[model samples]
Structure formats: C-alpha cells, structure tokens
Target: MVANDYQYILENMQKELETQAEKVGELTKERDNAGKKIGALEAQLSETKVVLDELELIGDDATIYKLLGPVLVKQERELALATIKNRKSHMETELKRCSQTVNDVSKKIAKEQDNLRDLHMKSQHVKQALMGAPQQ
Candidate 1:
C-alpha cells in the first residue's frame, strides 16, 4: 500500500508541472503580442512627427510655398493662387496704361508730321514765287 501511494503522488506532480508549463507559454505569447502592438504605435508616431515637422517648415517661410508646396502639400494653394491673380491684375492695369501712353505719343508724332508737311509745301511755293518774279 505504501508503494502505490508514492506512485500516485509522482503522477499527480507530473500533471501539475505540465499544466504550469502551458500557462507560462500562453503568458509569453501574450507578451509578444503586446510588444508588437507597442512597436506599431511607435512607428506611426514617428511618421506623424515627420509630417508635422514639414508643416512647421512650410509655415515658417512664406517663400517655401511657391517652390515646394504644390507637389507635397495642399494647404497653401488658395493663398498662392490669390497672389498670382493679384499680380495678373496689376500687370493688366500696367499694360493698359502703357497702351494709352503709346497712343498719345503716336498722335503727337502724327501731328508733328502733318506740320512738317505743311511747312515744306509753303517753302516750295515761296521759292517758286521768288524765282518766277525777278528773273531779269
């Protein structure tokens, strides 16, 4: 009877050991899953920081949007378009003023040309009259 009791105790201890080992294995798997979740979150955070840094750079310099903003970002596009429109409007006004100035100068030039023509005709007539009257 004593030998049988010893054998039963050893078998029960073996089953308990097996159960404990399975529990440890499950805990290890859960730890690895948690670690993976943390790693993914960290990577996403790094990407977000990079994007924010680029945005800060853009906001800092007014000149940056004209050169680098079109392909990379979309926030400052409306402001850039407004600036371009304002420049175009100014150029149109300047062109109109230049056109008016040119027109005025052309009219003045035409007036001068007409005056020269009249003077030339009068000079020719005076010379003809002088030559025909006192040929003796």
Candidate 2:
C-alpha cells in the first residue's frame, strides 16, 4: 500500500511538472516576441527622430510629400512635422507597453521555474522512497 501511494504521487508530480514546463515554454516565447517588438519599435523611433531633425532644418517654404497609401500627396512642412511627431509618440507608447509585458512574463517564468525545481526534488525523493532506498 505504501509503495502504491508513492507511485501515485510520483506520477502526479511528473504530470504537474510537464504542465509547468509547457507553461514556461509559452511564457518564454511570449517574452521573446515582446522583446522583438520593442527592438523594431525602437528602430522605427530612431528613424522618425532623424526625419524630424531633417524637417527642422528645412526652410519654412519647403514642400513636403506625405505618402498616403500608394500616392504621395503634397503637404505643408508643419503638417508633415506634426504627422511624424504623432507617429513617434504612438511608437513610444507601444514600446512601453511591450516592455511591461516582457517584465510581467519574465516574472511568471521565474516563479514557474522555481515551482518546477521543487516538484522535481520531491519526485526524486518519492522515487527513492518507493525503491526502499534512503532519501538523501
């Protein structure tokens, strides 16, 4: 009866370990995706800042062309500047959101890892007990 109970516990622990491992994999993927998104956004933000600086150097009467879908429409310099600024702001906000998501997912992964380690240790001890060996 004692051996049976230990076997049952070991099986259940193995199943739980598998589930937690799967969850960790998912959370790790999510964190990686979020990091990639942040990198892309940062690159875009850098490019936009350069454009904004160029716009600042342009003469007040300089004509700007805004790409609208498949067409390039003529726009005033100020209007183009405002549009770029808005896009930069939006990208900044998105970057912040992505960073936060990465942080949250990282924390979850860490906690799950700790749980998995504890489960693994318990499973090992149970296995030893079932085999009638001293558990170290």
Candidate 3:
C-alpha cells in the first residue's frame, strides 16, 4: 500500500512537470514570435521615418507619386506626408503592445520555471525516501 501511494505521487508529479514544461515551451515560442514581430515593425518604422523625412524636405507644391499595384498615382505632398505619419503612429502603437506582451510572457515563464524546479527537487526527495524505506 505504501509503495503504491509513493508510485501514485511520483506519477502525479511527473505529469505536473510535463504539463509545466509544455507551458514553458509554448510561452517561449510566443515570446520568440513577438520578438520577430517587433524586429519587423522596427524596420518598417525606420523605413517610414526615412520617407517622412524625405517628404518633409520637399516643397508643398512638389508632386508625389504613390505606387498602387504597379500604377503610380499622382498625390499631393501634404497628403503623402499625412499618410506616412498615420502609418508611423500605428506602427509605434503596435510595437508598444507587442513589447508589453513579451514582457508579460517572460515573467510568466520565469515563475513557471521556478515552480518546476521546486517540484523537481521535492519529487527527487520523495524518490530517495521511498528507496531508503524497507521493502515489504
């Protein structure tokens, strides 16, 4: 009966550890994907800023052409500047949101790791004690 109980305890702990490990793996993947998104957004934001700077250098009356599906449509410089500004603003907001998600997931992963470590230690001790016990 005692051996059976110990076996049950170990099995439960093993299952719990597996579940925690899987969660950590998932969180790690999420963090990595968010990081990639952040990188892409930063690159795009940099490109847009460069265009915005160039647009600002142009005079108000200067003609701007917006490429739409291989066709260059004539656009006013002011309108072009406005569109770029809006895009930059939206990208900045999205970047912040992704950063926050990364931060939150990182914290959760840390906590889960600590829990897993503690559980592993406890399970090891339990196994050792069971081994030292006299067999029926």
Candidate 4:
C-alpha cells in the first residue's frame, strides 16, 4: 500500500513537472518575440530621426511630397516635419513599453526556470525512492 501511494504521488509530480516545463517554454518564446519587437522599433525610430533631421535642414519654402501608398501627394514642408516628429515620438513610446515588457518577461523566465529546476530535482528524488521500494 505504501508503494502504491508513492507511485501515485510520483505520477502527480511528473504531471506537474511537465506542466511547469511547458510554461517555461511559452515564456521563453514570449521573451524572444518581445526582443525582436524592440529591435524593429529601434530601427524604425532611427529611420524616423534621420528623416526628421533632413526635413529640418531643408528650407521651409521647399516643396515636400508625402508617399501615400506609392503615390506622392503634395504636402506642406511644416506638416511633413510635424508628421514625422509625431511618428518618432510614437515610436519612442512603443520602444519604451516593449523594453519594459522584455525586462518583465525575462524576470518571469528566470523564476520559471528556477522552479523547473527545483521540481526536476524533487522528481528525481521521488523516482529514486520509488525504484528502491520492494515490489508487490
């Protein structure tokens, strides 16, 4: 009866270990995706800054063409600069949020990893005990 009880407990622990491992895998993927998003946002922000700088250097009277779905629509120089500035500002905000998400997810991943390791150790001990038990 003790052996049977140990067997049941070991089975439950195995299930829990599997569940924790799956969670860790999901969290790892989430962290990787957030990292990729941060990279993309940084590149976009850099491009926007370059465009804004170029616009600032040009004369106010100069004609600017805004690309709208492959069509170059005439736009006021000031308006174009303002639009680009807004885009840059928005990108900056998005980057900040994404960076924060990465940090938070990283911490969660670390915690989950530690939990998985501890569960694995406990499961190993249980397996050893189960194996050493006398068979019915």
Candidate 5:
C-alpha cells in the first residue's frame, strides 16, 4: 500500500511538473515577444528624434513633405513637427507598456521555475521511497 501511494504521488508530481514547464515556456515566449517590440519601438523613437532635430535646424521657408502611403504630401513645418512629436510620444508609451509586460512575465517564469524545482525534489524522494531506501 505504501509503495502504491508513493507511485501515485510520483505520477501526480510528474503531471504537475509538465504543466508548470509548459507554462514557463509560454511565459518565456511572451517575454521574448515583448522584448522584440521594445527594441523596434526604441529604434523608431531614435529615428523620429533625428528627424525632429533636422526639422528644427531647417529654416521656416524650407518645404517639408510628409509621406502619406506612397505619396509625399506637402506640409507646414509646424504641422510636421507636431506630427512627429505625437508619434514619438505614442512610441514611448508603447515601449513602457511592453517593458512592464516583460517584467511581469519574467516574475511568473521565476515562480514556475521554483515550483518545478520543488516538484523534482518531491519526485526524487518518492522514487527513493519506492526503492526501499531512506529518503534524505
């Protein structure tokens, strides 16, 4: 009866470990995706800053062409500046959101790792008991 109980416990622990491992895999993917998004946003922000700086250096008489799809539409300098600044703000906000998501997913992955370790230890103890050995 004791051996059967130990066997049952080991089986249950194995299932739980598998589930936790799957969860960790999912969280890791999410974290990676968020990191990629952050990188892309940062690159866009840098490009936008450069364009904004160039606009500032240009004289008021300089004509600015805003790209609309495949067409370059003539736009006032002030309007172009406003549009670029708004895009930069939006990208910044998205970057912050992605960063927070990455942090949250990382914490979840750590917790799942801890659970997996505990489950592994329990499984080892059960196996030892089944073998008629003293469980250390």
Candidate 6:
C-alpha cells in the first residue's frame, strides 16, 4: 500500500515540476520579445530626433530657395514620440505579466516541495504500520 502511494506522489510531483519549467520558459520568451520591441522603438525615436536637429540647423529658412517643412517635420517627431510611448506601454505590460508568471512559478515549486515532504511523511507512516503488524 505504501509503495503505491509513494509512486503516485512521485508521479504528481514530476508533473508539477515540468509544468513550472514550461511556464518559466514561456515567460523568458515573452520578455525577450518585449526587449526587442523596446530597442526598435528607441532607435526610431533617435532617428526622428536627428531629423529635427537638422531642421533646427536650417534656422534661416528665408535664406534658402526651398521652404523648410517645419510643420510636417514637427508632426513626424510628435508621431515618433507617440510611437515610443505606445511601445513603452506595451513593454511595461509584458514585464508585469512576466513578473506575475515568475511569482506563480515560485509558488508552484514551493507547493511541489511541500508535496514531496508529505510523500516522505506518508511513506514513513506506512513503514511504521507495516512494522507494527503482528505475526499470524
């Protein structure tokens, strides 16, 4: 009887550990994606800033034959900033989700450890019972 119970507990613990590992793996992938997205957004913003700087350097537009597209240029900068903000928001949400998943994984690992402890205790109890049995 004790052997069967021990086997059952071991099987359950193995399953729980596998599940926790898979969750951690998924969280890692999601975090990597978020980081990549943030990097792309930052690069776009930097490029837009460079364009704006060039526009500023053309301070005396009247001296130039062609007009300076200040309005359209500012709009481009504004849109770039907005895009950066949106990407940052998305990254923040992804980070939060990853944090939650990590916490859940920790809890699950703890629970599995507790289950192992229970199985050990039950095995000991079963051994004691078998030993206490009288001869027929």
Residue 136, candidate 6: alpha-carbon lDDT: 41
Off by over 4 Å in 3: none
TM-score of 1: 0.43
All candidates: TM-score: 0.43, 0.90, 0.94, 0.92, 0.90, 0.46
Task: Residues 25-105, candidate 1: write the lDDT tens digits.
Answer: 554455455455546545554554554455455643454344464565444644654555555555555545545554555
lDDT of 4: 0.92
Worst 10 residues of 4 by lDDT: 1-10
Candidate 4 residue runs with Cα over 4 Å from true position: 2-4
Tell me the number of clashing residue pairs for each predicted model: 0, 0, 0, 0, 0, 0
Q: What is the lDDT of residue 121 in candidate 3?
A: 92
lDDT of each: 0.53, 0.90, 0.93, 0.92, 0.89, 0.56
Model 5 clashes, total count: 0
Ranking by lDDT: 3, 4, 2, 5, 6, 1
What's the distance in Å from true for residue 121, model 1?
A: 0.6
Q: Which structure is stronger by TM-score: 2 or 3?
A: 3
Ten-residue stretch with the least lDDT total in model 1: 59-68
Q: State which candidate has the highest TM-score.
A: 3
RMSD of every candidate to native, in Å, equals 52.3, 2.9, 1.2, 1.5, 2.9, 8.3
Clashes (candidate 1) = 0
Which stretches of model 1 miss by more than 4 angstroms? Answer: 1-75
lDDT (tens digit, per residue) of candidate 6 on 9-90? 5566566556655655665566566556656656665665665555455544323222246532223444444554665566
RMSD of 5: 2.9
Q: In candidate 5, list every pair of residues with a backbone clash.
A: none
Instruction: Indicate whether candidate 1 or candidate 5 has the larger TM-score.
Output: 5
